[model samples]
Every structure is written in structure tokens, then in C-alpha cells.
Target: MIGGIVGIDQDIVKADVTPQVDTANTDISTNYIATSNDYGKIGGENGSDWTIDSNGVLRIQSGTWNDESVAKFWSSLKSDDGSNINAGNKITSVIFEGNIITGNSLASLFDSLENLKSVTVALGAKFDTSKTEDFQNMFSNDSSLESIDMHMFNWENVTSSLSMFYQTGLKSVDMTNINAPKLSDASSMFYNCKSLKSAKFDGTNFSKDGVKLPQFLASCSDLADVSLQNSFTGKITDTSLMFDGDINLEDLDVSSMNLSSDTKTSFMFQTSNNVQDIRRKSITLPADPNITNSKIDEYNTDRYKGWSSNLSGDIVPSLETYYSNNANVGKTTWTLVEKDKSQYKVNYIDQDGNLIETKNESGIIGNPINTTKILGYSDPKNSESQPDLMSIADNNDQEFNIVLKKLAPYKVKIDVEYGDGHPSESFSVDIPYGLTSSSAQVDQSILDKLASNDSLDLDKSKAFIQRIASGNPATEGDGFSLSTVISGFNIDGSDFKSIFNGTIDFVNEQVDSAILEGASGQTFDAFEIYFDKYEQSESHNNGGSTVSKEITDINQKSATFGDKETKLYNSNGVLIPNIQLAKNSDWKNDKQMILDGTKYYRVSTDAWVKASDVYVYTDNISKIRVHADNRSRIIRPNGDLSDRALEKSTEWKTDRYTTINGEKYYRVSTEGFVKASEVSEYK
Candidate 1:
């Protein structure tokens, strides 16, 4: 066995015998029989060099060999010798390649290879398992075999798989490689492969008569992932304990299974407590499954959602069907607010996850734009209408409009001189439309900016600017306070002249909250207004004037009307535009007087006046009116203070006069006299 004599492992007295290993592989090795079906005796106690050590691993040359030779090599392990070789106990791994297996059944080929950790079936290696039905103990008790790549091994016509892979040390196995088209009886096929984690079998293999899978993977605690739909579609009926002990299975999606006609599914998932979801919640039932001795009652939740059958024995959906049935029950509500041009309009939830119909860009009220409020959807832009002018007018979309439509209903009010704890500074109140208050009480609609903790409406934040500018009523809820959202839409120092201060900042603020979807009518509380003062332009007490002054203070001859009524006298000694009053001969000299408890002033002998009703001026003339009973107070148009009654019967003419709060008086010639309502040209 030295170098001088060719080594026992390499002795080749004959010529080279090379053959094709597979379609594309040629046997170039000098030792292996290069042809298939050589059937030479392989491993045994005899002269055959093939031998599995006490460790049970067949140590062969690391190269491709003929399948027939490999088969013979394996068969020798179970040869009819008076002494049984340690075939089952010692052969742990096989490293051989061949295709001659097409002539034989590999039923117990590697069954007892208890320590066999892995097997690499060579290319073109086909097992003629078509005619043979039994595959009992195929790789049984191979505890050390971690995996076997049988992709090249075909089992197209195999029918049975009892104890096929029982007690193996495999990690994951895809039995789809073994195309068992006629496989029906698969009981205990993978029983107790404790180390097995996943088992994926081909569905086509079980297309034949259904395969009974009772206790097939029983007690395989670590086998969490399983896939065997072939049995459901085939003629295999009895599946009593298919996954009887798969305790840690997380989810099982069986929606693809068509178990339309099965006889028994009792205890299919018996004691497998941890298995959670079994989808396609229902399994088919036979027209008449004999469950007299079965545990069908235990098949309710531990396995499928529910297993039920009436007189017709058809399986019905389980309670999990609720999800598959109710699709719209949880629809969310929200508005898709886009800048419609110059203003903002809220496209509220109108239909399935979409906004209501809206007038198109055309004033003609074109097809309503169904706004999308879907989570993953982006609203279409003006891009929908190609080549159309980006113009808002060319488009009825009113953001481009000088006047807003949707936000027009809302408002903001600016009440000046807000004197709280501060130094009586002026502030603005940005309230919703229809909100009323006192002060300048200007009582008029004013566009004011808000600055406070008011939230930007969740969905309406997108275009809150337009909403505020147009005074859209936040009537729905306590609308968003423009203050908090705006921060500063244009408050110069303290002047709130514009809502464009934090234009970009505010838009960023609403971008997130505004687009968030909501429940059907969810609303925000009132937008508590906040204010930024513009250097306190003007301040005072409770929005009132800081200083009080009358016109008389500026001009000695002019004064605001006082509280009392007054009278005047005419130099002509006759009362014109006559009215009834307490007449007396008052000679004159007094420009102010008091009658009873009120103050008064006399402009002429025929004219008497209430202090508050008279606006004094050096030469100012106001048209007088005869309201109710006009007392006797006559006067010449010039300037007079007398107690003579005005002659209402005399037809006096006036050249010019002024009206106050609608009441009018006239100057007649060089004398004063009649109420415009009661004289010529007065009306």
C-alpha cells in the first residue's frame, strides 16, 4: 500500500471508464464506475470498499458516482449477511451521486442512517417510486441528519408516506421536491421531527385522491411553520390530527385551501394551544362524515374559526367572518383643503373616502371634482386639465377670486383700545363669523388677525389663511384660533394689519393637523383668539376714548348740544314757522340757558333749543324741524336769543339749511324761521 504499489483506494488495473454523470456533466474521475446500472456490490462486510464508520457516515470519494453503484452501495448496508452491519447505527452522511435509482424503490434506502446528517442527491438521480406505494421509515430515526437536498429525486407517482421523515434532525424541508401526485396515505409522515421548523410541501403532489394526514406532524413542538395544501385538494379525507401538537405556530393563512369534500377533520389542531390565526376560516365538510367516534366538537377554535355542518354538512364561516363582511363600517371623515386659488374652500367628506363634488375651474359649474381624502392618495392638481390656463378665472376654483366663497361666511373683529391689566392698548379680536361684541362696536364686519391658543382645524389647516381672510365661519366647532396658528400673520410690533405675518409658518403648522382624517363629525373647540399689538397705536379705557373733548373747547362760538331745550326771539316781533312753547319777553344777551332741570340755549326770539340738540357755531346754520308740538320761540335768521314764540302760521322762506340725523331747518330771507318739513323747498 506504499507509493511503490498504487494505493488500495486508487488501484486501477483496467482502462478508464468515463460516462456522463448527467446531461451536462461527464465523469472525469478515474475511480468511479462511469456508467449507470453498474449494480456492482457496494458497502458490506465483504471486499466491497464502501463502509460507514462507527460514527455512521459513509466516507466515499468526494465526487459524482453512478446511481446504480450508489444504490448498490446503500443496499449493501442491509445485505442478507448473518451479521447485520451497523447500517442504521453508523451511516450518518452519504456523499455520492447517481441516476440509476430509476429502476428501484428507495423506500428504506437511508432509513436507519441514525447519524446521517445530510444527503446530496446528485443530478439525474431519479427514484422509480411511481410503482412502489410504501415509503415507511424513509429517513426515520436519522437524528443527526440536518438536511437532505432531494430536489433531483422525483416521487411523481408515490402513494404512501408512513413514517417518511419520522424523528429526523432536519431544520426545514420543502417536500415539494418529491412530487407525490398519487400520495394519499400520509399518516405520521413527519411525526416528531422535533428540530424541524418549517415544512413546505408542493400542492400538485397531493392532487390525486385526498391524502389522510392524521397525526402527520404530531409532537413536533418546534415545527412552527407548516404548508400542506395538496392534502386539502386531493382525495385525502381523514385529517384528524394533522397539526395535533404544533404549539407555537403564529399564523396559518389557509385561504388558498379548497377542502370542499373531507370526511373527518376532528381534532385537526388538537392541543396546539398557541396556534393563533387559521384564515379562510372554514374547511369543507363531507356530506356525511361519520363523527360518531370523532372529536369534532373540539375543532371549534383551537383549529379553524369554527367547524359546523347542518343536514347538508357544509362548513360555514366562523365569527372571524365579521372582518371579511363589513368593509365600510369604519370609514373616516376629513376635509381635503387645497388652496383653491386666492381663497380656500373646504372639500368635506362627501362619499367613500372622497370629498363632495365641486365646481370645476369653469364658471359654468363643470363636473364636480371628487376630492380624494384617502390616506395614501394625493389630491390631483390643476394638472388634471392639461394646457388650461393656470388662471383661477379660467378656473372657477376661487382661490384666484378677489372675493372668497367658502370663507366668506366667517369673520374677525378688531376692537380698538383693549384695556385689560395692560396700559390700555388697542387689540384685535379674530372671532368667527356672526360673532358680535361691543365697542367701536364699530359693530361692523372687520377682518382681524387672531393670535392665541386656537388650534388650526385638523383638516382645514391646509388653507386656514384663506379661511381666516375670507372670514369663513368656524361655525362647526370652536374654530381654530388664528393667533396660535398664525403666530404672526402680520402684526407689526402690535399692528394687526394683515393675516400674512406667519404665512409660511402658519401653513406649515396646519399642514400636519389639517390633513389628518377624523371621525364623522369631529370638531375643534372655538379658536381662542390671541393678539399682537402694534406699538399700541392707540389706547384707552375699555375701547373708549382716552380723553374726552367737545367742539366748544376748540371754538368759543361752537359747542355740542346740551341736555335741555332752549328758545329764541325774533327782532321783527313776529313768530315765523310758528310752534307752541312757553312764550315770554326775553330781551336777549344769553347764548346759554337752563329750563327746569335741563340746560338750554337760545338762538333767536322765536327759536328755543335743547342744549344737546344744538350744535353751536359762529355762523353755522342747521335746518330745524317741527317735531310734535313746536313751542313759541321766534327768531330772525341772523343771531338771536328770545322767548317769543315762532309763528308757525307765517310762510317763511329759507335759503340754506343743514339737517342733523334727518331733521332739517331753513333760513328765510334775512331772518331764520321754518322747519324744512313744514316750509317751501324743505322736502
Candidate 2:
């Protein structure tokens, strides 16, 4: 081929040279590493050589490579080309400086270097998703790698999908010096680093305007402590699983943390609301300024503390003494107070020199015992006046009864006291018994004497007799009058006088009237006198007969006139006056006129001895009788005399007639012969 194998040899030589050239061209075209600068050009001009020094700095020698250039170079190095530099070799260390490696290609570089121990990227090197598959798995299998300081780069919008520190053997981490000005979207940048012990978030580059991520340093059980800057405004919604298995985080300070609505189920301790300081062993309660012994007892009881007598020993000195002294007091403060007029409140204190409770017992002070009057009478002791005693009993159910005897009128005092030191006071009621005539003041000395005595057993019977003996005398001529006494005693005087006078006078009058009216031969005229006198005098002058003998004399004269009848006859004895036939004669018509044997009356005057006078025998006439035997018997016998006689007898027989000679007779009837019509015309 020296110009196509020199002409004649030229033709054959030319053909050989063309095939050789074509073969070389095909090799060049297919080998990307050979053509790429990704591998070293046959001279030492391209490709990257990574080296590590004893000082742990990773040195990388490259020619004009940025992150894209280094990534392309590493891609060639990991390819299967014969000219590739680090293919299938264990890289013990890598020192890279001033390189811009990024994207999934850069991660592929580290993945091929299985034995890589140390890698050092340049100070301004930024590895991104395109240069590597998130670069997170770049150091994933590199357990020998110990440290990483990626602070120099501006990781501002760099999405850290890589958790390069997780698989590496890192014992400690320091995030204090990191200035993540644009790292707002980094949620869990170091979520599961178990070897991490300490972390710091004291920078001002953090934004407070969004929902914060939880467990940013979560499962690092060795991470017992953390510090947060005051300028942090991240919201924590779910911190529950953040420390789920952390046992050493007892005193966590969450005071500066703000929570969102989703942050609710965080607390795990009992009495969570009562916990104040998270660093202390016990919590302080609200200050109870007035703690009483009773309150303490109640608290103790509620807490199930056993009862002890010493519980109240710490009470206020005053209250303690009151409790110890007054055994009747109850367990509450209000019970210690006495509800009465005095209104005294007891001051209670506890052992801590603080006032606990107060009790008021002043209500009962100065209250007097109530007294009531009981009506009663004492036994009579004297004849003159009775010693009636009135007593008073205190109405207080707690006190005893006291008897107060009468000392005088209109004033009564009870002598009693409440208790030992209380003196007996003199109290009097306005109204008193027995002395109505005059207002009299009770003798204090007498009451004092009576009160001082233990018993009230006086001889009231003897006293009464002595009082009567010493009574004021009645005035002269002021004889005891039943009417006056009865009026004073408010009794009916007439009834009293009637009771005082015996019934003997009335009985005697009744007996005498009965005897005169029912006697066998007594004249009715005599009975009239007695009955009239008795009736008129029964109630007057105590039944003394006010009518005297003159009345009796007139009665006797009337009786005699009624018993006798006188008839006037003509001198011729020619029946001039016939008592029965003189019905028209004025003289004969007198009520005193009667027909009798002493007064003659003729039936006819035709022919007869012209008798000068006629008279009926009256000397044989009996006293005027109310009943008679017959009309012509000259003395009353059983009546069968004659029709005329019977008729005359029937006329004389009445309730007003008297009996004479066993015949009925009126006051006008005479004890004389019968009429001539009865003697002659009937025969």
C-alpha cells in the first residue's frame, strides 16, 4: 500500500489495504469506550482515575469533567469494553475532587465498585438523580465507609432520594453545621439511622409555614437527647411511633413544640393532665390556703390512708384545744359552731401554721331559759285562807322543773339557774292569781327565801286556818245576808235562800189543808179559810201567816150567815113568806136567804089557822155540811125521800156544797125542815 502496493503490485496491494482499513474502522465504530474519552485514549489523555491516600482523602484525576462528564466516564469504566479502566475491580478507596457527578449513571459507577471503602467527592460536587439512580444506593453495600461530610454543596432544590448513610457503618452523626437554606421539602432525611446518638436543629434556615414531617430522627434508639431552636415552627401531627421503642426518653421536653389537630394520641402516662414539669418525680397541686383537719381527714380517707388519732394533732393550736376539750363536737367545721345568739366562730388551724377551718358557737351565749306558768293549788292549811301556790317549769327540755309558790298578788318570780356558775335571777310575770281587789307587789325577800329553800312543804292546812282567824271583821250591823253573799259569789239568791230554808213550813201547810178538806165532819167554810190563808202566805215571809184573827172572824161570820136562813112571815101566819115561793120578792131574793125550819114558808093561804109566824128548828141543825143524807130527814140520811126532795138534794149536791147530817149542803143551805111540797103534796 505504499501507494497501493506500488502499481502492478499496486492493484493487489490496494485491495489488501482497503480491507485492513475497513476492519480498523469497524472496530473503532463499535467500541464506545475507545472513542469516548470515557476511557483513557491510548496515551493517558482521558478517563478518570480515582485514588485514596492514607489520610482518608479520596483523589480523582480527570480532564475537564463536570458531573455529566464524570458520569459518562464512570459509565465507560463499568462497561465490558477491553479498554475500560475499573471494570470488575474492588475499589478500596476513591478520592474525588472538583467533580460534578449526577443522576443514575453516577450510582451505577459505585455499584460496579463492590470493594469500595472510602469515597471523597469534591467540595462543590452535586450528585443528582440523572447522574445516579438517586445516589442513595451508591454507598448502600459499602459497609467499610465510616464518615460523610456533604456540607459544602448547595443542596438547595436537590431532592435527597438517597439514604446513603443508612447502609454505611456510621457510629455518630453531626448535622449542626448544615445550612439547609432551601431544604424545606426534606421530610425524613435521616429517618432510620440506628447508630446516631445526637442531633441538632438550632439553625434559622427552617420554615415554619407547613406540616412538619414526623420521626425525622425516629428509630435511632441510641438517640436519647435532642435540641430544637426557638425559631422552629414545624407542626408535629404524629409523634406516636417516633419514640415507639425508645426506653430512655423519660424526660422529654416538648414544651416548645406546637401541635396540629391530628396530634391527639400522644400521651402514655397516667394522670397526664396533672403532669406539669416533665423532669420532676411528683407534681405540685394548686395551693389550698385553708386546709382544715377535717379536710385532711377527708383527703386521707379518699386516698385510703388508715385512720389515726394523730391526724388532727397538726391542727391549729386554738382549734386543737377546742377539739380536745369539747368531746361533743363533730367532724365538720359547721358542727363545731353553736347555733345561738352569741355567734362565735371558732378559728381552726393546721400544723403548718395555716388556717384550715372555722366554727361558730356564739349562738347559744346569753340565751335565758324559758319559763311557763302551770296552774295548780296547794293543800289548804288554815281555816282563814288557803295557801294556793302557783309554780313555773322551765320549758327547756335540757333543764329541770322549778316550783314557784305565791308570795304576793300580781307578781310571781321563779328561782332557778341554768347551771353551776349561773346565778338564780328573779323573773316575774305581769299576771298573778288570787288577789283581784288590789295591786300588790310580791315581796322579793319572801321569794328569795322560798327560792333558797330546797323544799316547798309548808303546813298549808294550818296556814289556811290561821288566815281565817286573822280575817278582817265585818262592819257593825252588817249581818250575813244570803242575797248579798250569793250575789258576791255569782249564785242565784232565791235558789240559795230556798235551799237554806227547810221545807217544813210548806209541808205543814199542805198537811193542814189536806186534813181540813178530807175530815169526816169538818165544815167546808173552815177549809176555805185555811186553804186561802195557806195559798196566800206559802212564799211570803218564809210562809208565816200574814193573815190574822180578824180574817178568821170575817170568815166565821160569813159561814154562819151561809148556814142560817131567816124568813119574814105575815102576822096572819098565812104563808106570807115562802122562801121557795118568794122568788119575785126583793127581800126574799137575797143570796143570804135560804129555806129552813127556823124560817117558815107556806105552800098556800086558802084556809088555815092564820098562823102569825112560822119557824124551823135550827138548834138541832149540824154545822154546814158539804153532803147530806136526805132533804126532810132533819139530818141527812140515804136519799129516797120524795121526787121533790130528791130534786132539791140533787141541786144542793155540788163540789162547793158541804156535808151536814150525812147530807149534801151548799153555803146557802140551812139545816132545817123540808118544803111543804115535799111533806104534803108528795104524801
lDDT of candidate 2 at residue 290, scale 0 to 100: 18
Task: Give the per-residue lDDT digits (tens) of candidate 2, residues 1-683.
Answer: 00101111110111111111111222222322222233342113343444323323334543333344232234345445565554324346554443433332233235334455544443444322232223334444445554454442334344332434444444344444344333343333445555554555544233344323343444555554555443234543333333333332333333344433344323211212222212111111111111222111111111122222222633332332344355433323211111223223333333344443332222132343222221111112211222122112222223222323332222222223332343434343222222111112222222222222222221110011111112212212322333343343343223211211111122222333222122222111100000001111012222454321000000101111222243434423234345532221111111111121122223323211111122112112111221122333332211223232232223322112223322223222232223322221100
Highest TM-score against the true fold, candidate: 1
Candidate 1: count of backbone clashes, pairs at least 3 residues apart or interchain: 100
Number of the top candidate by lDDT? 1
Which tens-of-lDDT digit does each residue in 1-683 have in candidate 1? Answer: 00111111211111112211342443333443121123233322221233344444453332222223222235343334554444455455554443323223445657756566656433444323344455657787778876665453455656667787888887777655345777778788888888777777645455455677788777777665666554255455776776667654534433334433345656665544433422122233332233332332333232233334332244434322422343332211111111222222334332244443332222112223222222222233322332134232324335321111121111222333222333432333322221111111222112222221122132222223443332233433334344444443443322122332333234323434223211112232222323223222112343453522111101123232222223433322223355533321112224333322333445544354554534432232222333222332434332353354444334332334433322344444333434454432311
lDDT scores in order = 0.40, 0.29
Estimate the TM-score for candidate 2.
0.27
RMSD of each: 39.1, 66.3
* Deviation of model 1 at 212, angstroms: 1.8
Q: RMSD in angstroms, candidate 2?
A: 66.3
What stretches of model 1 exceed 4 Å from their correct place?
1-81, 102-104, 123-132, 202-204, 228-231, 272-683
